[model samples]
Target: MFDMIIKNAKLRNAKDLVNIAIKNGLVKAIERNIEGKAIKEIDAMGNLVTPPFCDPHLHLDAALSVGDPRYNMSGTLLEGIQIWGERKPNLTKEIIKKNAIEAIKWEVANGTLKIRTHADVCDPRLLCVEALLEVKEEMKDLVDIQIVAFPQDGIYAYKNGDKLLEEALKMGADVVGGIPHNELTREDGVKDIEYVFELANKYNRLIDVHCDETGDDQSRFVEVMAKLTIDNDMEGLVTASHTTAMHNYNNDYAFKLIGILKRAQMNIITNPFDNSVLQNRTDGYPRRRGHTRVDEMLNRGINVCIGHDSIMDPWYPLGKGSMLQGANLLMHYAHLSGYDQIYELYDMITNYSAKTLGISNEYGIEVGKPADMIILNAKDEMDAIRLMSECLYVLRKGKVVSQTKPSISEVIFNGKRENIDFIVER
Candidate 1:
C-alpha cells in the first residue's frame, strides 16, 4: 500500500491529470489512473502541483528582530547595520533559536522548504552560529537549512573577524560568506574576498559573498569575486548576492564585468524587495532602483535567482518569508513580464534558487526524487504569480506540513448567479 497518494493534480508538463504516489518519503510513481489504497489521499481539484520554493539568500539570525534596538528612521543601509549591531549583543541561544524557528515556520507555511541563511559571525562568541546550528537540526525534517558564516560587520574591519569565520566553519557552516563592500577600504574589501576563497578552500565549503551590495559605482567587489572564481576555477560554487552596484556602473565597465562573470559561471541573487528599499539612500533625484543587472546577467547565460532577504527585520522592517512575493516584486521591478519571462521568473524561486543553494540535485517534484512539493490553488504558472497564490498544501518528505484553502464567493449579478474561485488557465 502507498503511504500517501495525491490524485488529479496538474504537473509541470503532463498533458492530462496524474496521480502521484509516495512511500517511505519517496515519490514512488506518477502515472495516470493509478489504483492505490493509501493511508491518506488529497484531491488537488485540478490545481497546480510543483516543487516547493527555495530561498537562496536570507539572514535568519537577524530575522524577526524589527524594532528591537529601534526602528530604522533614516531608512538607509548603514542605519540598519547600526540597529542590528545594537541588537546583536543581547542575542542568546534561546532567543536566536526561538526567532529562527519562527521564521522557518513562516517559510514552510508559505511553501518554501529550502533556505540558505547567512548567520553573522562577527562576534567572537559565535552565539548566532551556534544557535542557528541548533535551529538547523531542529527544523531538518521540515526544511533544509544551509548556514553561511556571514561576517556582517566586515571581515577585516572587526578584530579577529576572520578567525571567527573560520571558527564558524569548523563548528559547521555549509558556506563561507563575506561582506566586502562594507569593509573599511577598497583594498581591504579585495583582501576580504581573497580571505573568503582561502577559508572556503581550507574548509572545502561553498562561497557566497554579499558582494557589492551598495549603490556606489566604485564598489567593484563583484567583479573581483567573478575574477577569483575564474582564477580558482570554482564555477557554480560561487554566488554574488546583491550586486546592486552593477546597476550604477557605467556601461563600459559593466559590459566587461558581465563577460567575466559569464566566464566564471557565477550565480547572482537579487533581493529586489530588500535592496530596492535599502539601496540608493544617498541619491537625490533620478534615484536608482538599487538592484543588479538581472536581465543582462540572464542574457549572458549566468544563473540569476531572487530571494526575500529580510522578514520584518532591521534591514527593511517588512517581509513574510514568501518567495512568491519576492518573485512578484522582481518581475515588476526588473520588467520581466513576457510570457516566457514569467515562466523563467517562476524558476528563479524554485529551480534557479535551488541551483544557487547548490541543492538542485535533491530538489524538485519528479518521481524518485524526495517527496517534497507543494500544491497551489492556481491553474498555471502565470496564475500562481498573478494571484500570489497561496499554497493549498505543503508536503515535506511526503508529510503534510501546512495547508490553506482557496476562497469561493457567489454573488447575484444582473439576476444571474456567478461563482468565482479565481481559477485562471493559460
Candidate 2:
C-alpha cells in the first residue's frame, strides 16, 4: 500500500481528474483510479494541484522590521536604506532570528517551500548572518533556505564591505550577492560587478545581484552582470534581481540588451509588490511603473521569475508572504491578463522560480519526484490568480505539512438561500 493518495485532482493543462499515489516520499503512480487502498487518502474534489511556490529573492535579515526605528517618511528607496541603517546597529541576534522564523513560517503556511534570502553583510559584526545560518540549519527539514551574503551597501563605497561579505561567505552563506548600482560611481559599479563575479568563481557559488533597481536610464549594471556571467562561463548560474531600469531604457538599448541577457542565460526576478510603490517615487504625474520589461523578456525566452522581495521590511512596508498575491499585482502592472499569459504569470511563481534556485530538475508532480505539492482551492491557474486562492493542503515529501479548509460562500438571493462558489454558468 502507498503512504498517501490524493483523489480527483485537477492538474494544470490536463483535462481529466486523476489520482496520485505517494510512497517513500515520492510520487509512486498517477492514474484515473488506483486498484488498492492507501494508509491515508484525500478527496481534492477537482481542486488544482501544483508544485509549491518558490521565492527567489527576499531580505530576511530586515523582514518584519518595518518601523523599528521610524516609519519611512519619504517612502523612497534611499529613505528606506537610511532607515535600515539606523535600525541595524540596535539589532540583537535573538530579535533577528525571531523575526526571520516568523517570516519563514508565513511563507511555508502559504506553500512557499524554497526561498533565497539576502542577509546583509555590510555590518562589521555579521550578526544577521550568524543568526540566520543557525535558523537555516534548524529549519532545514521544513524548508530549503539559501542565504546570500548580501552587500546591501555598495561593496566599495562602504568601509571594508568586501571583507565583511567574504567573511559572511566563509561563515556559511550559500550565495554571493551585490548591489552594483548603489556604488558611488560608474567605475565603482563596474568594479563591484567584477568583484562579485570573482568571489562567485573563487568559491563556486551562485551569483545574484540587485542590478539596476532605479528609474535612471543610465543605471545599467544588469548589462555588466550579463557580460560577466558569459565571460566567467557561469551563464546559467547568475541571477539579476530588480532590473527596474529596463523600463526606462530606450527601445534601441533594450533591444540590444535583451539579446545579451538571452546569450548569458541570466535569471531575472521582478518584485512587483515592492517595486510597484518603491520605484518611480521621485517622478511626476504620468510616471511609469518601476519594473523591468517582463512581457518583453518573457517573449524573448529568458528565464523570468517573480519575487516577494520584502515582508514588512524597510523597503516595502507590507507583504503576506504569498507568491500568488505578488503574481496578482504583477498581472496588473505587467498587463498579463490574456488567456495564455495568465499561465505564464503562474509559472513565474513556480517553475520559473525553481529554475532560478536551480531546483527545477527535481521539482514538480512527476513519478519518481519528491511529493512536494500544494492543493489549491481553485480549478486552474486563472481562477487561482484571480481569487488568490488558499492552499488547501501543503505536502512535503508525501507528508502533510499544513492544511486549510476550503472556503465556502453562501448567498441569499430573491428570498432564497443558496451556495454560490463563484461558478460560471457557461
Candidate 3:
C-alpha cells in the first residue's frame, strides 16, 4: 500500500494535473491518475506543487538574536561583529539551542526544508557548534541542517582559532568555514584559505568561506580560494559566500577572475538583502548596490546561488527567512527581470541552492526521491513569484510537517460593484 497520495497537483513545469504517490518516504509514482489506495490522501485542488526550498547561507548562532547584547546602532558589519564578540562570552548551550530551534521552526513553517548555517567557532567553549549539532539531530525529521564551523573572528586574529576550528569539526560540523578578509593581513588572509582547505581535506569535509565580504576592491581572497579549489581539485565541494568585492572589481580583473572561477567550478552565494544594507556605507552619491556580479557569473556558467544570509540577526535586522522574498529582492537588484531570467531566479533559491549545499540528489521531486515538497496557492511558477504565494501545505518525507489556511475577505466597493466575497487561498 502507498503511504500517502496527493491528487491533482500542478507540478512546476507540467501543464496538466498529476497525482503523486509516496511509499516508504520516497515518491513511488507520478501519473495523471493514481489507482491504488493509500493510508492518507490529499486533494491538492490543482495548486502548484514542487520541491521544498533550500536556504544555502545563514548564521544559526546569531539567528533570532537581534539586539540581545545590544542593538546595532551603527548598522555596519564591523559594529555587528564587535557586538557579536561581546555577546559570545555570555552564550550558553541552552540559550543557543533555544534560539536556534526557534529559528529552524520558523524556517520549516515558511517551507524551507534545507539550510546551511555557519556556527561561530572563535570561542573555545564551542557552545554554538555544540548547540547546533544537537539541534540538527533533534530536527532531523523536519529539516536538514548543515552546520559550518565558522570563525566569525579572523582565524588568525583570535588566539588558538585554528585549534577551535578543528575541535568544532571533531564535534560534528558538516563543513569548514573561515573569514579570510577579516584576517589581520593579506598574507594572513591567504594563509587562512590554505588552512581551511587543509582542514577540509584532512577531515573530508566540504569548504565554505566568507571570502571578501566587503566593498574594497583590494579584498582578493576570493581569487586565492578559487585557485586553491582548482589546485586541490575540490570543485563543486567548495562555496565562497558573499564575494561582494566582485561588484567593485574592474571589468578587466573580473573577466580574468571569471576564468579562474570557471576552472575551479566553485559556487558563489550572494546575500542581496544584507549586503545592500551593510555595504555602500562609505559612498555619498550614486552609491553601488553592494552585490556580486550575478549577471556576469551566470553568463560565464559559474554556479551562483542567492541566500537570505540572515534573519533578524545582528548583521541584518529584518527578514522572515522566506526565500520568495529573497528571490524577489534579488531579481530587482540583480536586474534579472526577463521572462526566462525570472524563472532562473526561482532556481537560485530551489535547485541551484540545493547544489550549493551538496543536497541535489535528495532535494528534488522526482520518483524515488524523498517526498519533500510544498503546495502553493498559485496557478504557476510566475504567479507564485508574482503573488509571493504562501505555502498552504508542506510535506516532509510523505508526512505533513506544516500547513496554513489562506486568508479570505469580503468587500463592497460600490453599489455598481455589488457585494462579493473573495477567498484568498494560499
Candidate 4:
C-alpha cells in the first residue's frame, strides 16, 4: 500500500531495527516495525541509513579541467588561478555542460544528492552560467543543484564584472557568490562583500561568498560578511566558504569574529582537502595548517559543514568527488579524533551541510520528510568514516537511484583459507 519499504535499518537515534515507509515521494512512517506492502522493498541488512550528503561549496565550472593548458607546477593558489584563467577562455557551453554533468554523475553516485556549485560569471561570454543553468534544469529530477553566480575575478577588479554578475542572476542563477580576498585591496574586498549582499537582497536569492580563502591574516572579509548578514537580518541565509585565513589570525581577533559569526547565525563551510594543500605554499620551516577553526566553530554551536571544493580542478589536482573522503581529511587536519567529534564529522557531511544549503526541512530520515537518504555498509558513524564505507543504496524522492554491492575477498595464506571484508575483526 506504499511506494517502497526499507527493513532492518540502523538509524542513528535508534537502538532496535527501524523500518521506513515511503508514500508518494515522502517518508510516511518510521518505527521499530513497519507493516504493509509496497511496490519495492529493500533489506538494509543492519547498515547505517542516513540522509544523503550535501556539499555546500563546489566549483563545477572548472571541475575535472585540471592541466587543460598547463599544470600548476608552483602548487599555489595564485598559480592555480592563473591556470584556470588560461583555461576558461577556451571553454564552450557544450564543453562546460558535458564536464559538469559528468562531475554530477560522479557525485550523485557517491550519495551527494544536494549541491551548491559556483559558476564563474566574470567572463564576457557568460558561458559557465549558461551551461550550469541548463544543467540545473537537466538534472533537476535526480538531484538538487543550486547554481551560484560566482565572480572568480574580483567584482570591482574588472570594469564590467558587476554587470556580468547581474546578467547571470537575470539568467536564473539561484545564489550570489563572491571572492573578496582576491580583490585589488582590502577596502575593495570589503566593498565586494557589500556588492554581493546587495545583489542577494535584490534578487531574494541565497548568498554564498568565498570569503578570505587566502592564508594572509589580513584577508578578513568574513567579519564584513557577518556584519552584513546580521544588519540585514539574513542570518541562516548566508554562507561563508573557505575562510582559511582564520587559521592565521591572533586569538583576540579570532574570538571577536567568532562572537559576530554566532550572532549572525551564518553558515561556515570549510574545504579541508583543497585548503590544506592550496594554502600555506609561501611559508617555509613552520608552515601553517591553512584550515579554518572548524572544531572551535562546532563547539560554539555555529552551523559548520565540509565540502569537496575541487574535483581534479585547477585548485586541487586530486579529488574523487567523495564527501566521506572530504570528512576523513577534515578529521585529520582539524584533529577531530575524539569519539564524539568523529560523529560530529559525519554530521558535517550530512545534516549540517544540508542546513548550510538551506535544505534541512526536506532532508534527513524522519517521518513527513522527503525520503532522500543513503544506506552505507558500516554499522555506525565512526565505522563509516574509518572504512570510507560503500553506499549500498541511494534513494531520492522515495525511489532508488544507485546501489553498490560490497566486495569480499578470499585469502589463502600458509595453507589457511579465510574470508576478508572491509571491516577487519580479530
- The Cα error of candidate 3 at residue 169, in Å, is 0.7
Candidate 1 lDDT at 280 equals 93
- Candidate 2 off by > 4 Å: none
**Clash totals for all candidate models:** 0, 0, 0, 0
Instruction: Mark the 10 consecutive residues where model 2 has the least summed lDDT.
Output: 417-426
Tell me each candidate's TM-score.
0.97, 0.98, 0.96, 0.98
Instruction: Candidate 3: list runs displaced more than 4 Å.
Output: 415-426
Question: What is the alpha-carbon lDDT for the whole of candidate 4?
Answer: 0.90
Best candidate according to lDDT = 2
Candidate 1's residue-wise lDDT over 1-426, tens digit each?
999999999987678999999999999999887786899999998889999999999888988999998999988889999999999888888988898899999999889999999999999789999999999998898899999999999999999998999999999999999999989999999999999999988889999999888889988998889888988879999999999989999999999999999899899999988898999989998888889999888878889998889998888888888888888888988889888888888899998889888888888877899999999978877888888889999999899999987677898999998998666444
lDDT of 1 at 375: 96
lDDT of 3: 0.89
lDDT per model vs. reference: 0.90, 0.92, 0.89, 0.90
Error of 3 at 43 (Å): 1.9
Model 2: C-alpha RMSD to truth? 1.1
**Candidate 3 residue-wise lDDT, 330-376, digit = tens:** 88888988888888888888999999999887888899999999998
